[model samples]
Target: MSLWGKTDSFTYIMNQTKNLGLAVNVISDYDRTNANEYIKRKNVLVIIPSLVENSPYTVYECLINNVNFLASNVGGIPELIPQEHHAEVLFIPTPVDLYGKIHYRLKNININQGLLNHKTILKKLGLSQLNEKTTGAFKKIDEANSPLVSVCITHFERHHLLQQALASIKSQTYQNIEVILVDDGSTTEDSHRYLNLIENDFNSRGWKIVRSSNNYLGAARNLAARHASGEYLMFMDDDNVAKPFEVETFVTAALNSGADVLTTPSDLIFGEEFPSPFRKMTHCWLPLGPDLNIASFSNCFGDANALIRKEVFEKVGGFTEDYGLGHEDWEFFAKISLQGYKLQIVPEPLFWYRVANSGMLLSGNKSKNNYRSFRPFMDENVKYNYAMGLIPSYLEKIQELESEVKSLAEHQWWSFCQ
Candidate 1:
């Protein structure tokens, strides 16, 4: 009959309640203890009208005190309530329906009978009871004993896109995360200003910022890794956004599989002309089958879409700083494979990769130097593999000539001229 909270419809509510002969209590602010006691002793039904919620903790109190509850079944509220309590909790879709439910509950007509299955409720909320004790999976995720994930991000201008990437990490379902931001010498005044503002915002949210006087992706990332103090390190790009469940999904899969490195497919953002490698090559799961060649390394898992244990990085020695155009991830992962470390594919699109219509490589940097540097990196790696006997000499011979194969072809006119 009456409404609470700050509302502009006070006049309408007061007239309606008066006409219905019901007293409407209006309290602007009150003591927390008194309110809790009042809610426990007096309130017959608690109605939460908000259609959107992150997590409704008040519902927990209501359920614990054995009070009848009603709410709009939108956003995360429905998920918080147990499936068995669907009918009893009264997820009314409209004002008329809410009134009808209230009338039924008032008459004690057993409208919500047999709807409180606590076991199923706890399970839906990712909780359980072993023996007589309740176990909370959500609680365990934030405990100090849980593995802390270090998310390493490198930035060089593009303030337009960096905010989204940072926000994605903040929104992750996994809570034990420490963000390491390495600013690779932002040259522009606007970039510096924007980055300073962003730094202030995220510093309060638990992100560490490292500064560099020069621009190098490999070096910047290595610097960030040095500052990280987590059990695992997940590399991310400034241009990409991660899904909310990305970390949780990857961490769970990694723990279960017991792999030193984990990779996931990425969803492409902003360019239909370019297709994701995962979409094109669905069978590219790791533990790369018998293909210890140069080309295999070219198409291996990407660092932006992967998670590596900290020990693996320490063993292989972070990233190679020579190639700044960014082939370090492929080379690092390849070395791990050759060294007998296990790699597992999560087989899900966990992050977004930004692609433009023209220019630039997958890393979002457009430099002619990349083509020249990447070639030697690939060739020298193959040569090393051959010298180490990891790959056969015949394969090495084939790889060496791959770049000049077109020029070395025999001409058909030579026989006619002779």
Candidate 2:
């Protein structure tokens, strides 16, 4: 109705095609069932003008739906104009105001929801991005607590799985939490059905559904982060189940340790098989190590059960967007560890990270490729993991070779080939 800003911004929001974040993009979508060709684009920014607040879809797109960034001229918009970590809160007076939807507000210029001309920026401090796929596991929080907590679940093509994950949160002991579902480019009929379920069934529980760009997990999480209001934030996956006390435990731990990040082991179980050996490790938090060698620690990298203080997440600039599909958490952990943030890897198995057999090796390979791709940007984690997985095998092979050599030499004095 009120075309307050230039047409480009409105056109951008109105013409969004991908269903990547469609659930979150579509206001009140409960079933989360739909499919579309909406690609989660990057490098392009979105500016949600104050004028479109009257539009039914404005809050969904502006808040939950992922955008590189957003700039808004704030006022009385949607009753629930999605609030991220530091999207312009309470609204700004300036018409051309920028609210750094992905980042936070600075003393100088407010970052628009969309384009952030680095040159126009007085100082450019990169904000951390979040995983496109966050979880919606609910947990208890005290009423007097300083900051509220919100749990976000990001889903791509796994609508049925997403329901299981969200239901676990819905059934949590914690009632003070909210659930935000991120539809990461899953524009299918089934996905839309699930989105509708979330919006209609759980409205009283502060439930919200959103869409994210075709952008991978990092951006998806970042997109969810854009809409979260909790003083603290928690993550979960669509396919995994959460403990009744999952959120309660993490919040308690965060309160106890005063650290930015805290994690507990996720229970590893299969449909009908034994748990993988890697999932059986005994250790919890990554044993602290020097920067050069920490990447080599196999125990430190996985995200089966992990939590980070919201402040710590914002401080670390979130997950690296470059890692579209894999190794995003590894890089995130490495970066935060290097920054002297206190972390607690709780030994308790409080969550479930489903490493299903359907795509087990394939998942590992993709993660490995992402690790290799990101290895160049950071440290040589590839060599580190390779050496760890290989050196033992090489040693065993050498021992066998020595046994053969010894037996052959007994038969013939010069058995070098053996």
Candidate 3:
């Protein structure tokens, strides 16, 4: 391996190697146009030792060639490798830590499968070929009267990410907005310190921060909702970042459509590189009909992307805390749909969903995703909804059939084992 350029760190690294008696090569004035082919031919892995970056395209070029890469996990560098591929990619925190890691990779590194996945991501992002959806314009609401919007954010920890999220909100084009931040019983000193700083700076402009005693997602969001003072309410996750035009675009859609729930599709962004903002997207959810039809409950549109009217919150009684962590958003959407509230989807990617390497979805945390652990709570909720006439009887029957199918599959496996 060689250092591609001349730098103080490179010089220091070279000097450090004097005791070990190893050869050092500094490739000067290397042409980037031929870098990929050069790297592929040499079967050499690219090492990016930058302390700060924002989703560099050089990493993708390496991916295109199936060449292994080592990057410091700063800025959006951690997002270069998808959450599923974190185990394979080297995400180091310090440059000195790369010494042992680089040697380990020389002996045991297979990146062909990662290359295939990278190709899939490129296709998914439509980066190879531009399309109409990526190029379309965001529709505007023609009214001049902008209503106040309460943006509710519920956070537990990860203060660094939350700071970015708050900055994104502060930079919104729609100025007639209020932010309600709820710190859900953060036990970390770092979180408390960050929240205290935010409280001093952003406590005005109808912004309020509440610190609760430890109540998880649903309750924390409910606390924020209760304190909100806007006609329209937007739920945001602490880890997610909103576009500058996000609030304006969604408000325009909501005002034009007069729908109870206005939502737009979210695009996945690794690190900090967001796609061209406020563009029409091909993957938006369209209603089956003009009204709240029965088919609306089949899929959960996710609460993070939703902008609901404050009245709708009062009618549906916010989210059901009894349902707990996993399916609370799904159940809330289902409940509101059953109550005959209209849902209108804004056909643009207004939100940037940060897919981190470790989270509830990808961390393989049994405490979060275990079906058996959640089955009883889900079953009781279904029965209660059916009893209260909030859900159709057919849904209850469908649940029973689904349970039967699961049991039959388990029994078949047991029989095979016998």
Ranking by lDDT: 3, 1, 2
Could you say which candidate leads in lDDT? 3
- Candidate 3 structure quality by residue, lDDT tens digits, 1-418: 3454655767777787878876777666679766556777545767877777887877777766677777666787666676666645665766567876777766766556354346567787676456554355434644555888999998888788888788889889898889999998889999999988878777566589988987867788889999999999999988887889889987888876778987777766666443445643444333333222333333435445578899998887887564334545655666665556887677766777776666654544333323322232244434432222224334656787899999999999999999
Which candidate would rank higher by lDDT, 1 or 2?
A: 1
Summarize candidate 1's per-residue lDDT along 191-210 as a digit string, tens digits.
78887787777778778988
lDDT scores of the candidates, listed in order = 0.67, 0.57, 0.69
Checking candidate 1 for backbone clashes, the offending pairs are none
Clashes, model 2: 74
Cα misplacement distance, residue 383 of candidate 2 (Å) = 19
Clash pairs of candidate 3? 76-271
**Model 2, span 1-418: residue lDDT tens:** 3343655544556565444454324332333333111312444344454543444454445344443334343444424433342445433535334433323433322333432323333134223222222234222246654356678677888876776677678667666677767888887898777777667676766677887556767777777777888767777767777777777777777765576777666665555332333456443333332243545334354472366667778887886675334666666766666566776666566766666666533554443544532342344433333234334335666788999999987878656546
lDDT for model 3? 0.69
Model 1 stretches with alpha carbons more than 4 Å out = 1-145, 271-297, 358-418
Return the TM-score for candidate 2, rounded to 2 decimals: 0.50
lDDT of 2 at 381: 36
Rate residue 375 of model 1 by lDDT: 36
lDDT for model 2: 0.57
